[model samples]
Target: MSTPFPSDETAKETPASVSKPIKSAENASLVDSSVALGFPEGGFTAWGTVLGACLIQFCGFGYTSAYGVFQDFYTQTYLTNSTPSAIAWIGSVNAFLVLSVGVVSGRMVDRGAFYPLMKIGCLLQCLFLFILSLAKPDGYYQIFLSQGVGFGIAIGLTNIPSIAIVSHHFQRCRAVAMGIVVAGSSLGAILHPVILNNLINRRLGFANGVRASATLNSGLLFIANLLMRTRIPPQLNAVSYTRILKNSSRDGAYICACVAMTAFEFGYFFEVFYLQLDSTLHGLSEGFSFYSLTILSFGSFIGRLTAGVVSAYVGIPNTVVGSLLISSAVIFAMIGLQSAVSVAVIAASYGLFSGNFIALMGPLVSYLTPENSHIGARMGIMFAISSVGSLLGAPICGAFLTSHYIWWKAAVFAGSVATGGCIALVFMQVILKMRQKASSVCSKEAGV
Candidate 1:
């Protein structure tokens, strides 16, 4: 981050408006230029933020991933009176708010409210978890409020910093950094469900299990809150947020990519929430059912890291297209899956593809953005726009499940919609590449 100004020669050669974007590539090269940015990239402090981001993301997304176990338990027992669709609303609302509330969080980030916002998020997340622990016996509304809305808002609040801090620190290794950060969520997905499953089965029981997780996450969140720092703080009031929104409209490929994100999210959580239930229904033993989710999470962990490495070489859009195609194929293949072993294998494949998809999102957004003028606003808008699918994806899947009493209907919905998403993504990639090629030809003609 050099000052958002062009040198005199460049200014003379290009219009002021054009100069800003001309430096975008150089500015992103936050590599070993300590004078431009306040700190050098890949330092101890930068890596510290990466670690913190990983912890925060792990807790935030881990909670979402672990909800499948909770969904199964509640439907079969505590919230048994509620329909599957209704009960699924808890996680849906959670995912919805986690994404939709990002507008406010993004603003807070631009205003340099990182620590305070994250602190609030930490408290609220832990408090809501404790509330959920107490509310299980009280009924659906209570669980919805605590685990869904409250916890979601909390995660949303903290999520800005978790994502933003990476940009503040790394540029050269950004994809790799983000991959590592997201892998935290994968790790959490594995640990939380396993922890909860053991506790619910032979250990502490449901109430204590939820409480234990809350306690554990409280500690982790606290550490992240301490270690995650916003490097090169944003200048408040500098970004014209409204203007950025308007500029975004000019980028058709970006808009199409966002749409693809929304569609993909529509089917994103289907297996995450249903695999264990499917296992149980298909007559797999209880312990194995829980372990299946762990397997998926583990596979996802590998996928995230591998995607990071691959995307670094292959480019984000290409990597995304590849992953989306694979994930779509896996989802469609689930329609006939019956045996626990087969389902488990499919789960791992889905995990690899979907994890890669998630891992590449940050890089994809970075590529689509023409300038880095308002990263926070861009992230918030993209998240809010894409959140609708997450809001309803699980509940709709639950409807398919409840209606059919089998996996076929749910599989159909998730798989078909996921394929639609892949098509949209492919079109987006084409549009983006075309735009880039046209820009390249224009630049060559100009011969600066």
Candidate 2:
């Protein structure tokens, strides 16, 4: 029964081969190389990584959070006759660009391309904002092209890289870290309206107010660049382009998540802009509208934090589905209410769901993807689809409002979309459960 292979006793007695030493050296070299490339064995401190993630989020998402301010001003001052749907496209384009570019940029981050992209994104974002500052009231097209397209690209490039970096730096505490980071968007949402309102109500006028906000945002973006300068470790093997296009079970979840998110975006953007419009129409003080939005943002901040902690225990998918259901119910309730207090409740409720959905997305995407390699691209695709919803939601809702339909009718529209999203999430959960069961069965059969 002797074979050409050495016996166990003989192998034990044999001198270790030269390859053993070479392999040991290679492993040591890899560890050293990883360290040199900033791949800390234990990763970055959770607090520091979260802070960096928050800064990036502030710069990238603040613009999104600030859309209400812009939409209000644009409608009232520059484009009074413009349809809500039409005005939505500007913000939609911005949102789309922010998301669409993420696909490529995310892959770049997974490939160790974060730093350069971050630098370029920061510069371009600042430049675009500066250009946006110079936009004339009449220059709607330029504003759409510059602020929407340019800013979108910059945010997309910056956002995904920072998010991926956080994922690289943390695992167990990731949901909490992501929550803290995503809360920056709510912070921006809280501040942007107040800043815009103060600026507009002051002698400075809307243009000056926008310029001031843009200047401050530019500085914040620079700070984000400085704070978010971590490098990612390269993958051992590069993923082929074809693989990027292939749909997996995870991709189904991603698509469902994206679709749900899109519906949320549609409803959210419509409500924010329309709330302001309704407030103005009802002759409420600008302060009231601003304060209402602040309250919503505050609720969102709390919601994100709560969802993050809850997701750790209840799981992201379950939390997301629950949040969507709550959001849907709130939207349905909002339809029957007319008072300012009721509207504020609706806003706050919407914020809670919005924050939960957004904060969960990164972690969910991580769970669904084969590798973290295409996090950016997948995020981009998700957002791009969501942007389509945003682009259309406002205008469609506006059309409903302008056509002599009751304001509550618009709520119905939004509620219906959100309900559809909730249904999608349910299906996504079923698919996930089935897959998990199948995996368990396979493992049992394999005796491991």
Candidate 3:
């Protein structure tokens, strides 16, 4: 006689009882684990995560993009006799710090040390901005040291950790999430200048305008810090820096990519400075340069959003390549057009190109590296190294401009750099493909 539940011996022989209980138990266990993990039953919280990431990116990267406005104001009002290169250092250092500090900060976040670092960084950034606000006319060095260097350090600490947390919170819709987050920087770039322009025109002057902007940024950062808590479990192990560097292998292509990025930074910064300077030279009123920058920022905002959607489909490397090529063409075109239409075109093109590059860099580093663990260090190295270009590009261009007003030459220089950047990206793609093929071959061989 058979029992209500078949005996193991009988089940093995009967096949009816053999599979059902085991399958039921397995399904029950899976449901239990899913409940424990707290992951949504299906799909991901894409919208919420993307919104959070966007807010953080807007605050962290927005100020960085808006540096062009400060660069223009400083050069024209306070540092008139200072070399463009000299002034460029302030922005370069800020950018460098933002990029370089990621190595330590990224590891810290991985190690569960995000809160203290972020708090300190936020406070320091706010203090520096306040210090910059108090700067006297011709206090170029003070502003540079305070806003550029100080703010750079602050951003470096905040950026990677904030981004890392976003990665932990979402899985399926990461690209869209990242794109939305990064677009905040473009938004900031667009909005900040309008505010600054209003204040400057209202007779607040550059110092007062900057101070007000700084206060607003500081308040926003303070709120951001409050909201920047981690939503994921910390990594159990520290990421090995040596391994990260080893994998990044200072190959010819990698070096070339760095060079191209540097050149891009230089050209980008030069154009930013030149736009305002040109407005002045063409006899536009003080407020006009800010308006032009606002236009450029608006273009950048649209560009970043477009790049996100495009990169998602065409591939990040391809998107980067396409953007660089288009940017080069735009720079050359800007040389001849003097009409408002031409200026708007140039501004929009610059914004689009710059935004695409910025959005692409995060994915590009991932594409280049072997593991995601070292993303922070690799990014830091990239930023630190590329900053040399930022340091020199403007100065060299500025030196040429000092003797005579050859704005077209600067545009040519920009175009050439962008073209080279496109070439470097092509090589990077080739290397990545080869590496993937090698990886696949090794796996197959091991299986055999």
lDDT of each: 0.74, 0.66, 0.64
Model 1 superposed RMSD (Cα): 6.9
lDDT of 3: 0.64
lDDT of 1 by residue, 352-425 (tens): 88888876776677677766555446656777877888888889988887834667788889888888878888
Residue 365 C-alpha lDDT in model 3: 67
Pairs with steric clashes in candidate 2? 85-395, 99-380, 102-376, 103-376, 103-377
Tens digits of per-residue lDDT, candidate 2, 1-448, equal 0000000110012133322222332233232213322223243454566676677777677657667777777777876666655676787777666766766786676555667898898888878877876777667787888877888888888776676666554445554555567667677778777777787655577667667867787777776655654432344444454555565423676678778887887677666666666665556667786676677777777786777688989998998888888887787775655567876887788878777866676567666666554554455556656767766777777777663436787878888998899998998898789989999999999996
Local error of candidate 2 at residue 46 (angstroms): 8.2
Candidate 1 worst ten-residue window by lDDT: 1-10
lDDT of 3 by residue, 1-448 (tens): 0000000110012223223222332233222111222222123343554454456556666667666666666666767766665676777677667766765677676565767877787778777777877877777778778877887888778766666655544444445545556666677767766776676546588668777877787777766665544434444445466775566666655665666676677667666656665665666566665678778777777776676688889988788878877876876775775655667778888877776876677666666655454555666667667766665666666666653567777777767876787787778778778878999999999999
Worst 10 residues of 3 by lDDT: 1-10
Per-model TM against the reference = 0.86, 0.80, 0.80
- Score candidate 1 by TM-score against the native: 0.86
Any runs in candidate 1 off by more than 4 Å, and if so which? 1-37, 40-45, 167-177, 312-314, 374-376, 436-448
Model 3 regions lying over 4 Å from their true place: 1-56, 250-256, 285-288, 312-314, 370-377, 429-448
Q: How many backbone clashes does every candidate have?
A: 0, 5, 2
The most accurate candidate by TM-score is 1
